[model samples]
Target: MTATERPDVRPANPHFSSGPCAKRPGWTVKNLENALVGRSHRSKPGKARLVEAIEKTRSVLGVPADYRIGIVPASDTGAVEMALWSMLGARGVDMLAWESFGEGWVTDVVKQLKLKDARILKAPYGELPNLADVNFDNDVVFTWNGTTSGVRVPNGNWIADDRKGLTICDATSAAFAQDLAWPKLDVVTFSWQKVLGGEAAHGVLILSPRAVERLESYTPAWPMPKIFRMTKGGKLNEGIFKGETINTPSMICVEDYLDALNWADSIGGLKSLIGRADANTAVIAEWVGRTPWADFLAKELDTRSNTSVCLKIVDERVTALSEEDQVAFAKKIADLLDKEGVANDIAGYRDAPAGLRIWAGATVETTDMRALMPWLDWAFAEAIASLKAAA
Candidate 1:
């Protein structure tokens, strides 16, 4: 366990933050050279680029022909906020929270929106709330994947096929790497920065026919902001779904996303993307199987995420330390890896328990994940040695 004995092979690509994840293996700035930089987004060519992005997204995600998809502002957060503000007041809502982002939505429903009949369902960082307890009679809001905790719903089997209320889902981290049951989901939202590794500040909002019906038929009691408004004069605004954005957009970022979509298409579409993510997680799973000190933060294997794979240090020596000391020890491991240029931003989310969180999405290379395992071992040994010296 000598800290001095470092691994000779390093990951060729070391950019693995959960968001703004690793780009396609061969991506370059030169790829965006044809971006419509100086033109107005309202122009014919500009709108065509936006339309192409939407069309490609629909094709790759296998969204239904009857469903509507729009690119929105403020990334996934904006898309989720728009859905919550515009639709939740129409019915009693079920809000589920198992991680930071899910908890944020709960706060908005209870504190901000002040919905009287909202039911809060919660679980700790390593687990999920009871799916059986959710009342499909009420509008349901939940995350398909808990990014900060690395736990996700096993599948969409629990959702009722004949439910009366709309199901709003914030699926920013789950869209590409996992299967999203579109029939069960009424409102689905994701960002460009996640599985596809494109730039941020934009979100993709997909809506089933039922969700559109809710928007067109019922309006929230609260005043809707201009960005959140999806209807005009008691009808759904058809232009927004057709790439006519409510506000100006970054053409450069749109081109980057198009490039990412083109890459996904070239590599065999959604099936290939899911396979890549699963393979990356398998590499980490193998490492965790033999390493006594490292374990998944997820409590159940069925719910474990293939994309944002979180790990907790279970070594007796480290666990015996004070809570603050344990956090510092985890930081030390991450810092060592950072200093050695083997990994970056592998530290867990600030609100979660002290651990490592690695991005294993479609864009991350499996070879890099294999290369990362030995470095993690080296870093953990070094951190433990440092603790003994300090004591």
Candidate 2:
């Protein structure tokens, strides 16, 4: 394709960002007009909004009735650290990492916490760690989807139903779009910025009956920060799960989340949301099937992520270059697309393998994804030609 052979159709919205993702299709600040911004989050109206967000999340995700869900500070990272700090020292632990965020957790557990009885399971940027080797007798921590790698756990089939220890999952990229195995999972954390396409700096923590029991039973020797505390005396902090956050929350962000939740409901809730994401991915999959230079970073079809779809450039001209040159070439393609108003913030993460990572969550329209395909083809060809000219 030549540089001038631009596709006639364009994505109506060029917001394929993975985090703080594309907002609800028709979102407007006016939707959050009654945000209770001036009121304290502890006030009845503000608390009611927070509770509504939690209850709506519970309903949309089909979380177990007995599970406890809470709004927490510092987004998904905060919620995950809170769980790790509070519950890990009780027993031996297994940590799995395949991508940037997962690796961050690994760093925290190994370097910062300095736990004695910890096993690390690792994989490269585009693959998943071996799940079959995981020890269910010990607590297990993993991400439901590696946002940077675009590789996700195929399903919860690998998890043991009767495991003695708990499963702590960072499902920041999977919550509303993926089917979480609630019974097998003990603790789950996700941010509002991903699939819901809402505000950032806020996280939701979901815990099962087993997890709540752990909170009641175990106590870490380390000094737990106030933001990470989820227990009072010897029992669970029931109020936190009931909209009593451990710290102050942004009421406007809470309202934004509520608006996204209502949008999910109007679109048929969880099943429909998952379907939309699946369809968006299917579009890219179809495009990749015929595109010679591009392929999914995830080697296994089953593990291919339907949300953050990481793609590698395999065109010989590009791959023939050194790794540094390959990165620069990929950046050119991404930059050209951005300049053309074709897509925004679609670059692969700093820690991820050199490639393009596009967001394919529920908020993204299928038509837009289809439109973006031709542009991707154009960008690759154009970038390669320019790279050769420079060479």
Per-residue C-alpha lDDT of model 1 across residues 226-317, encoded as one tens digit per residue: 99999999999999999999899999999999999999999999999999999999999999999999999999999999999999999999
Stretches off by above 4 angstroms in model 2 are 1-4
TM-score of each: 0.99, 0.98
lDDT of 2 at 85: 90
- Taking the tens digit of each residue's C-alpha lDDT, what string does model 2 give over 1-391? 4534888889999999888899989998899898888899999988898899899999999988899999999999999998999899888999999998988998999898999899999999888888999999999999999999999999999999989999999999999999998888999999989999999999899999999999999998889888889899999999999998999999999999999999999999999999999999999999999988999999999999999999999988888889888888888888988999999989888877788999999999999999999999888878877886887
Clashes of each: 0, 0
Tell me the whole-model lDDT of each prediction, alpha carbons only.
Answer: 0.94, 0.92
Clashes of 2: 0
Q: 343, model 2: CA deviation in Å?
A: 0.1
Residue pairs with clashing backbones, model 2: none
**In model 1, what is the error at residue 355, expressed in angstroms?**
0.3
